[model samples]
Each structure stands twice: as structure tokens, then as C-alpha cells.
Target: MKKYFLLVLLLAGSHVMVAQTKKNGVYTPDNGNGTFTNPLMWGDWPDPDIIRVDDYFYFVSTSMHYVPGSPVARSKDLVNWEMLSYAVPRYDEDPRYDMKGGNAYLKGSWANTIRYNNGTFYVGFCTPNTSRTEPGHFSICTAKDPKGPWKRTIFKEYMYDPGLFFDDDGKVYVAHGQERLFITELNADALSVKTPQKEVYNNPAFPYLEGSHMYKVNGKYYMMGSTGGTTGRQICLRSDNIYGPYEAKEVINDDHTYPGNGLHQGGMVQLKNGSWWFIIMQDRGPIGRVPNLEPVTWVDGWPMLGDKGKGVETFKKPDVGKTHPNVVPATSDEFNTAKLGLQWQWNHNPDDQKWSLTERKGYMRLKAGKAAKLSEARNTLTQRVQGPFSAGTVEIDVTGLKDGNVAGFGVFQFPYAFVAVQQKSGQKSIIMVNADSTVTTIPFKGNKLWIKASVTHIGYTASFDYSTDGKNFQKIGNMLNMALGLDWTANRFALFNYSTTADGVSGYADFNWFKLKDSL
Candidate 1:
């Protein structure tokens, strides 16, 4: 009996590794080989505000209406990180469903998250609706916690993208606006302004739109923000005054070479070796926004990018002094533990009343919610596409996956193509893959099941199995060629779930794990 039990355990593990199939899921960062080009961070990680605190570097980015918003990512070596938590105040939480990029009613905050003057951390962001009613702009939020019940502060009418700075002299100032860049002084607390705001600088020399982060180096102050449209246009600026004669300089140009430089609010941090590095953002079209770390040096007393400079057309990792061997984490999951990891995301707007994890069923429970006719990848409830050229498997034990609606394991190319293993109440489990809405479905009616799906550069395949001894398996074949009819629409890798049934509804499912495999 002991031998039989051991065999059963081995088979359960083998279910994910029966064949050494080369699949696509583990994405390797560009080692600057020129064959591939990729930003250091993948998917909607715009307006990065990073700080080096001790050996641990902390970064917080824009929420833009995605729920459990204001995701804070932590890193030790600067190259890799893990999602920490949303820094927004949870009172009106669940994520904004306002007229945002994803449909959240309240677009939480925009840019510039900073930690300064001892342990006080500051995040600068815009909540659109507040200032819109007053004039031409939105209200900005200032918070002490990267994850916060923040204090929303609106300074002026018709202004957006507010940034705060604490000069070495202990003076605090606030800067923001559109068409023309603006700046004003905030009292000591760095919360409210003591003076009327004024124009700092404006140049048709740039689009002069959202995403502005300012800092002082030597004796000059530099202002960096996004220009042109918020999607792919970006650059940087500098001045000697808190309010300028702000000199607009081209850091990353809007061109084919490094095309995706989208949201451009960022600055430099000093490492233990005293070398400097900066974090910038660029949106990878359909894959959404992501951050990129660039190595920088003081040239001619001004700043210049190092080996991999400015707008990068080719993919490569920044020469951030030295590479810390271990940084990035495993993208897969096994539900053996009770807590859901921080890497998951919910659809456009989340109604969490329908989901739970009580340890009773040993899996995630997703009760049905009023399903909107939502297709935008942002609205489907997704997470960052883990890596570019990698493979992984999503395992779901559907023996008890049931609800008035459907639940499944799916690989998503957001706002569009997705393939899922869905189960409906009193019905056989089904496999779904689609490009637009034209879906192909397969059925499986079984209990005590182990389902695994593998991915590769060529595409992906889903398999189902039942084992009496947990080994020497009987196979269930209904494979999917993700490459065929696969939506090549630019997408970040992600895992997703949702409800199409109704509002005030309910559902549940048990996902075994999601395992990521590396080719190299």
C-alpha cells in the first residue's frame, strides 16, 4: 500500500511532465542579442515611481482604473520584482469603473510615487472626475502608503499629472498642467499649496501631456513626462529653477528605433555601488503598459543613457552595474497553500461579493457576477503576460468546478483571443479557443481528473487525464493549435477569469496550479 501511495504521488507530479515537450511561456529578457527586443518589464506598468530603500528597491505605478489598484512591486536587485499590493485607499475600493482606459468609473491615480524625507512615502496621481467639474483638469491624490487609504488633494482647476519634490534644502514644491508645464510651492507637509500655481515652461517642442516626475541633481532640476499621445510618445526635460526656463531635452525620441516608449514619468536611484539607474515606461501596444530600467550616467554635468541609450529599438537588459543571479520569481502556482499570490488581476470592474477561498473546498471560488459584454483585454480580468518566450501549464481540477455559469483554465491574449477549459453545471467540461468570438469547443465528462496544458513558441496544447494508479495514464486528447487562428494582436502574457451570467449571482472552481517552464 505504501508503494502504491508513493506511485500515486509520483504520477500526480508527472501529470505536468509526462513528455519533455518544448512549449512557449518562459520569456527570457533580451540579453541584447539583437535577435529579440523587449522592455525590461512587461504589461501596463506605466508612470513608475521607484526608490532604493536599503538593499530592497520599491516601485509603485499608476492604477488607471484596474481594481485592487496602485500595484506596488518590490525588488532587491533592481532587475526583477514581485507584485506587492494596491496602495489606494480601500474605502471606495474594488477598482474604479469610471471612464478609464479599462472602464472603471473612477480612474484612481496617474503618476509619480516617491519615498522621501525619512519613512514618508509619497504617490502623486490624478482622479479625473473631481477637477473636471471645476474646470479643465482632474484632482490628484497624495498618499503616505504605497498601499493606502490615501488623502485625495485637488490643488487647481484645469490641471493634471501633479508631481511633488523635496529639494535637499527642505523645500517642497508641486508641478502639473497640460499644453504648458506648471509648478507651485506646497507647505512643509507636501500636501497643500501655499502659493498660486504658475506656468513653469511650455514648448510646442513637445506634446506636453500627462506623466511628469521631477528631481534635483547637482544644482539643476529635471522634469520628465510623457508627450504626444499617452500611448507611445515620450521624452524628458530639465531646468535650474524649481519653476523653469525648463529645458526640454530628447531622452527617448518618438520613432521606429524604440517605438513603444509610452508613459514617461521616472527618475534615477543610487545603488550600493553608487552607480545610477533610471526606470521609464513604454506601452507595448496590445500587451498594455510596462516599465523599462535604463542605465544612466552624468555626462557634461547633465544626464546621458549608457551603452543601451535613449529610445531603444533593439531589446537588451540595462547594464545595471552587476546582475543579481536570483531576482524574478516563478510564474506558476499550486493551490496547496492558502493565500492567493499577488500576481493575479480582475476584469474591468470587480464585484468581489461573488468569490471566496475558505479552505473548505481547497480552490478559488468565483461566483457569477453580472457579466457585461466586455472583450477589452483589460476588462476580462487578467494578469501580466509572465514572460515573452516561455511556456507554462495551467492545471484545473474540475471535478467539483460548478456554478450557474462557467469556470475554466485559460491562456489569454487580452481584449481578444483566449482558449479556456470551461465547466458548466451538470455538463461535461469543455475546451474553448477563439480569435475574435468565433470559438471552437470540446467536451469532457469525467471525475477525479487531472488536466494540464503546455505552451511553446509554436503554440499551446491542453490535455486531460484520469489515473487509477496516478501513473500509467489513460489520455484524453483534444488538443488546440494556438498558432492556428491565434490572434497575433500584440498581447502581454496573462491568466484570466470572469462571469457572463448575471449580477447578484454566484459560482466556484478549484485550480490545481500554473507551472512555468524555461527553454534555456
Candidate 2:
């Protein structure tokens, strides 16, 4: 009896270990031991900027053209993170943001900077000039808390890839520009420029130098930036004066984690335990630019990243004094809440009258908006597709859809695709739209349907499936070979409803729930 009991206990322990290693049926970086893996969160969290406020670490990332732009997250141990809020509530700078005469696909917010000073937090980013009518500008947001009722100030000047810095004497300055770097002092208010821009460091060796993150450590000023675009390397500059004759070095130029794509363009933060870590991004094809957390060691005066400048795949977690529960960004949503989940973001600015979570009680109602193509559709909700493999499934009610309406779920990118239910001339049919504008149709008469998009990072492919009953799903479309277009973003899972015609009473589709898993 004693021998049998020992065997049962051993088997139970093995099961618990396996369960702890995964979150929501997805492989997490946290190994449940003391070590963790790279690509920290396993998604397209690009242009990351991290700051340590007391015992907590606050993170912000670039969210171009996505309403509720610039996502923010908080972590206690740096390995475990939770989605806190967004710094920019919406893009109110131009009419294009609303998809009025045009669209802002890759031109909203880019390369953001986050810093904390004297009980106030600041996030700064730039919007590029899209056309003659829509000019580019810089915007700064301030709040006491990261999860904020943030106050925003827009400036006419376009400061590309800004790095907000606070000097020892309480002077504030912004380091910005593309290949040619410049530093401008901010007024006491830290809202507008107080001094004219000065050329700080512009070396021909480091071309395409941008994403500046300025820091002052031990009386020496350091400006960290990335060169070589997406396939780039991290460059660091050291100077006695904030502006001037600086020494430049290639701090990190490695792509061991994801070969051929070097880690670059992110900021560093000092933990409460007095250790430093660099949060940089690695471009992983169509899935998007994912962030990697690397250890930082100060050699002489320069902060070297990774294991002697090579990328480390697995390393001991930063000793934040204690272990925290494993957590990943929330993905699955039941549409039971008054508002959409933090993971969800509109492709551009959404039409206020088009989408609602309260109208159907437990469903998210998306009214059809007129659009020539899915790329131009408004109120199209999206979230990042996870790495390795992930499947996003949604239960949608097509009964509410009207004629000329199309509603379904699929991968959203430059060359996107979806498996949707199309209603035309009072007839309904299930159709699969490929990335190359090819469509395959099959007649369908169903009120409720479950649609899914399965994405795999290995081959960078996305395929679609659908089901009348929730338990079983049938494959629909040919495999989509995803590619990174001019959007400068990873492919995302999107839910959309739009009208092909500009007439009649446009209807809506109700999404009951969105569930994510490793596979079907």
C-alpha cells in the first residue's frame, strides 16, 4: 500500500509541472524554474521602452495606426507582465486617423519614449507626414499613473523617434532625428522646445541611426540607438557633455535567437536590485517585431548587452527579490464586459456608432461600415498573433447581417486574408478570401458560426477554418504565405464586418466570444 501511494504522488507531481509551464495552452517564456527564454512575451511588442518606478517596471511600445495607440504594461519581476493601459487614447491629430478621405495604415505613432520624473510619467512619439494635407507632428502625454487619464500636448514640429531625458539639474531635453541625430532642450513645462535643435552625434558608420534612448549614468551621457533598419545592430555613444564629441561603439550585433534578424531598437532599465537589462526588438518576418530581454553588463564605461555581446536564448531571471506568478497578455475575450479587452485595438480610429458591447448584452455587435476592401474597413478589431503557433477562434452570429455585408475572422496585414460569411441579394454563402485577391465560396445557411485563423511562425503561414457547431471546424482557405509589407508591423488576427455596397440599411454581426489556443 505504501509503494502504490508513492507512485501516485510522483505521477501527480509530473502533471502539475507541465501545467505550470504553459499559460492558456500556449508556451510561455517562464520555464517554471529560475530561467526564462527570449522574445519575452512571444508577440509583436516592438520599439519597447522600459522604466523602473519604485519596485515596478513600466513598459510602452509603438502602435502605429492602431486606435488606443501605444500599449503600456507593468511587471514586478520583469519576467511576468500584465497589460496596464495605453498612453495615447486615440489619434486625434488628423481626419485620416478616422479614415475620412484616406487611411493611416503605417503613420500614426512610431518609436515611443517613456520616462518618469518627480511623480509624473511622460511618453513621447512622432507621427510622420502622410500627404500634403496631413502634416507630421510630435505629441507628448503625461500622467501620474501608468494606467492613466493622460494629458496630451501636440506640437507642430516633427521630432522623429524622440528620446525624453531629464538632466541632473532638472533640465529636460529631447534627443531626436533620423540618420542625423539632434538634441533640443525642452521648456520648464517639458511640452515645447525651449532651445534650437543642436546636432549631437551623426556618424557615417552608423547609417539609419534612430530610436534614440538617452541616459545619464555616473556623470557621462549615453545615447543608445539602432542602425541598419529592421536587420540592425545596437549602437551606443558616450560623451562628457550631452552635446558633442562622443565615442561610438557597436554594443550588440547578434541574431543568434532568430538568425539573420539582429536585435535592435529598444531601451534599458535599471531594476530595484541595482542590475540593468536591455529590452530590444528582433524582426521575425510577417509575425512582427518581437521584443527580447537581455542582460546588461557595464564593462569600463559602456553597457554591453547579452552574453559578451551575443544574444542569449535563455538566462536566469532578474532577481527582483521574489518570484511572481506567471502571466501573459490577455487574449481570449467573452464580450461579456462593458468595454473591449485591452488586447483588442481598432485598425484605425473606429466609428463611434458602429461597434458596441452593451447592445447585445453578452456579444460584441459590429455594425457594417462601407468600404471598398477589407483594408479600408472601419471598426476592424485586431490583436497580435502569438509566436511558434496560435489559433484564434470566434463565435459570430450572422443572423444580424444584412445584404451586401461580409463578416468573419482572419489574419490582418498588408496582404491579408479571411474566411467570412457574405450576404448578397438576400442569399448567404461562406467565402474564403486569399492574400492575392482570390476567393473561394460555398453556400451556407447558418445563424451562428465559429471561424478560426491558425498562424504558425516557423513557415510564416496563416490558414482559416469554420464550423456550424462549436466543437468541430472545417478547413476553408488555402494556406496564406505571409510577408512583411511597407506597414512595418507584424500580421495580426482581426475581426471585421463591412458593407460592399453603399446602399440600404447596413446591419451588424455579433461576436459571442474569441478564444485562443495552441491548435484547433
Candidate 3:
């Protein structure tokens, strides 16, 4: 009895320790006394566009191929931010509903969500549909509120990663498309181009790069963006005029001591003190594409990033700006709320009625649809992988079992991925590991059970385990490399589920919190 009691005590103690740990997610704004870290918004907040509206600051980012598109956020000091909502709701409304857009474009919306003239919010976006024997198109949207009863205006196709800049002279020009900086004039309502369009800056040619933000500061126009790619490096450039003579200057890139990546995407905001700072996105390759904060300086009106001496990184708020303290939210969720959180997104366009909560059921029911293959399912729900250099376990309780049905969690690295857990067959369930639709069964006792998958980037292993009680885990197989996802390589670690049956799995998954831990 003493031994058993001791075991209970040990278990209780471990749970407490887990609760006390720093709940991992994005790093919030520091109090200005200390330096901040990279990935300010960790998982997949790509092509960020931010605006300083008085004392309050609002930001938005692209959520490509991930549903519930156009992530909206608000912050006071430009540090900590709360997710607002999908800038544009309902994927079916998207012109490209079926895989017609392909994985290249199905990714939720990308870039520029901000309020434009006359009390309406505007967002310039890119739709890179690779499936079609065509390039891509750019569109603009308008909303009364940031939370949005948003509407999109169809226009002639132009560029990707489009950014709308309203100059002081009352002229609205769009600096757009990826690979190069293309520009065109938009009507006063900020919709389509009225003037002949021109490629103001070609990024691939010399220096103008990705995630370009064109701003007017002190009567001078500055264009800062990610030059290389989020992983390789980044740089900022500026010009005295908006039209021409734009020069590229190095910001943060291969020159830094902590030069971890070259490609970067995000926005730059000026503080009340008139100092400059930047937040950019980067792909850790393993963690998925995430955000990072870097302090920048304007020497001779040119932004200097990283360490001028060694060109590395920073935590100090920097003399350039004042610091503000704030908190976003804890990541690990208990699923006790009625509304789904923004941290989660669907694979592509989704069906609204397909997923539901009856309140009394206390679980989300995803009915099977015409989606026999993941490629067919319009909505393959996925959430950003929220970890960095860490070890974590995904625990889920599934009640339904079907041959064509699958529900579990695994690290998502894209095109080639795996789901290591139970597959439902009406009422019976079996433990199995799914990689790229291929299943390897690890026979279990019943249909109702708990599944735990532990991921280790160290050994490049993703193991499957099951437990009646959340302890004494039994390994199902050797490590699974996540890079082998379904269609393309995923940028972040994510949790996903899909069922292709006629009735779908007539059950629910009790998705518990992920006990997140980092590898020191």
C-alpha cells in the first residue's frame, strides 16, 4: 500500500511540475529591461503586416494552405498580441474551392490586413494556384471592423504578397508580388488599379526582396522586407522617392553572429519615441515557419539589423524604441471552450457544417464527407506546430474506430507526414501509425483508448504509444520522419485529423493538452 501511495504521490508531483513550467508559445514583448528572442509569434505567422493605430497596434499575417485564413492580432506596445479572428471567413467563398488552386495556393490568405481610408479595413493578398496551368493572382478586401464582416473585390491578376501603401500625397500604390516588387495604383476606395501598373522593384534582379513594406517616413520612402528567404537571412532597403532610385541595405542576414536564417518576413513599426524595430518570420525547418523579433536602427536613415560589431542578435529593447510588457495566452488547451481557438487552422478550404459541437457531447464531431482521400477532403484540419528545439507528447482520446477513419497527432513536416495512433471502425478502434496514407497497425485492445505520440528531433524519431492510464507508455515503432507529409513539405509542426467515410467517424476526439517540453 505504501508503494502504491508513493506512486500516486510521484504522479501528482510530476503533474505539478509540468503545470509550473513556462507554457511555451510565442515570446511576448519584454519589459524593455532585457533583450527579446526570435520567433516572437512562433508558428506560421507568415508575411506579417502591422500598423500603429495611436497607442494600440494591430497586425495580421498569411495562413497559407491553413484554413480560417488571415490571422488578425492586436497589441498595445507592439510586443504581446491577442489573436483577433479570421480576416476573411469561410474558405468555400474563396474562388478556388476544390484542389483547383492546388497546395501552392490553397494555403489560407497571405499578407497585408490593415484599415484603409474612410473607416474600412483593406488587405492585399496573393493566390499562387500551382495546379492551374497559370501563375497566380492578387486581390484586395474591405471590412468595417478588423474582426470583420469582410468582403473581397475581384480584380485583374497582378502579383503575390501584395502590400498597399497610402502615401502622404493621398496616392494609394500597391507594392506587390513575390520574387520581385511590383507596383500599381489603386482607386480611392483602395480596390483595383486605376493607373497603368509597373514593376517598381524587381527583387530577384538585385536587392528588392520578399515581405516588402513600403512606408513614408520623414518625407522619405522606405521599403523593408525579407530578402533571401525566412531561413537563410533578411535585409531592409530605402529610397528618397517611392518610384525610383531605391537602394538595398543589409539588415539581418548571413552577416550576423547568430545568422541562423536568410529568409525573413514580417513588419516594421515605429514607437512613440520615433525609434525603429522589426518582427520577421523564419522557418526553423523543424518548428515550422514562425516569427522572430529583432531591434533595428536607422543610421543615416538606413536600417541596421543584427549586431553592427559581430552582427548577431538582441534582447535589450534598444535605444531605438520604448518597451512595453504584455502576455498573449498559454498554448496547451483543455478544449473546454465552445469556440475553436485561432491557433488551429484547416488544411485548405473547409466545410462549415462538417465539424460541430453539440454542447452536451463535450467533443468536436467531424462528419465524413466526399473527401475519400486527404487530397479530396476540402478541409483537412491542421494547427501550427508550437515548439522549438523541444520534446513534446501529443495525447488524444478517441471513441470511434473505422477503417477509413483516422484520428491522432504527430509532428507535421509537410508532404510526407505521419499520424501515430488509433483508426476507427464504427465502434472498434486499432492502434496504427499512418505515414502518407500508409497504415502500420499496432494492435490494441479496444476501440476506446488514449493515444500518446512523443517527438524527438534529436534522434529524428516520432514514436507511437498507448495507455489506459496516462503512464507507462509502450512504444509502437521506430522514429518516423515527418518530412514525408501528404502533398508538400510542411513548414511547421502541426496536429491534424481526417476521416473519409460516408458517415465519417460518428464519434469525437477528446484532444487533451500537449505536455510541451523543449530539448535544452
State each model's CA lDDT, in order: 0.51, 0.85, 0.57
Q: For residues 323-359, could you state the per-residue lDDT of candidate 1 as single tens digits?
A: 5443343356654555556655554454545455554
lDDT for model 2, on a 0 to 1 scale?
Answer: 0.85
> Best candidate per lDDT, number?
2
Model 2 TM: 0.94
Against the hidden reference, what TM-scores do the models get? 0.72, 0.94, 0.82
**Arranged by lDDT, best first:** 2, 3, 1
In TM-score terms, which candidate is top? 2
Say which prediction, candidate 1 or candidate 3, comes out ahead on lDDT: 3
Once model 3 is optimally superposed onto the true structure by TM-score, how far is the C-alpha of residue 271 displaced, in angstroms? 0.9
lDDT of 1 at 456: 31
Ranking by TM-score: 2, 3, 1
lDDT of each residue in 1-520, candidate 3, tens digit only: 0110011111212331111122343334343335544446544566677877667677887766566667778776655678876766655544555455444344446565454566767776776656467565676767778777778775666566676788777789877655567677877777777886676666564443666777787888877666655444565557777776677766666422223455466677777777776766655444455555666777887777645622323356544344455466445555556777666666666666666545434454554444454444554555555443344455555554345566655555444344434454534344354445555565555434455555433333455566656676666544666553423234344444556665554534545555444433
> 1-520 in candidate 2: lDDT tens per residue?
0110011111212331112235766557687788887768778888999999988999999998898888889998878888998888888767888999888889877888999998999999988886788558888999998899888899877788999999989899999988899999998778998997899887888998999999999999999999998789999999999997788988999975565788999999998767899999998788788888899999999999999779777789999988888888899899999978999999998898999999999999999999877998988999989866789999999898888898989999978999888898888899999864757899988888899999886578898888999888888869888877756788999999998887623689999999887752
Q: Which portions of model 1 show Cα errors greater than 4 Å?
A: 1-38, 89-106, 129-159, 228-234, 254-265, 272-274, 308-325, 372-381, 390-392, 399-404, 411-414, 420-425, 429-438, 447-506, 517-520
RMSD of 2: 5.4
Task: Assess the local accuracy of residue 296 in candidate 3 as a C-alpha lDDT between 0 and 100.
Answer: 71
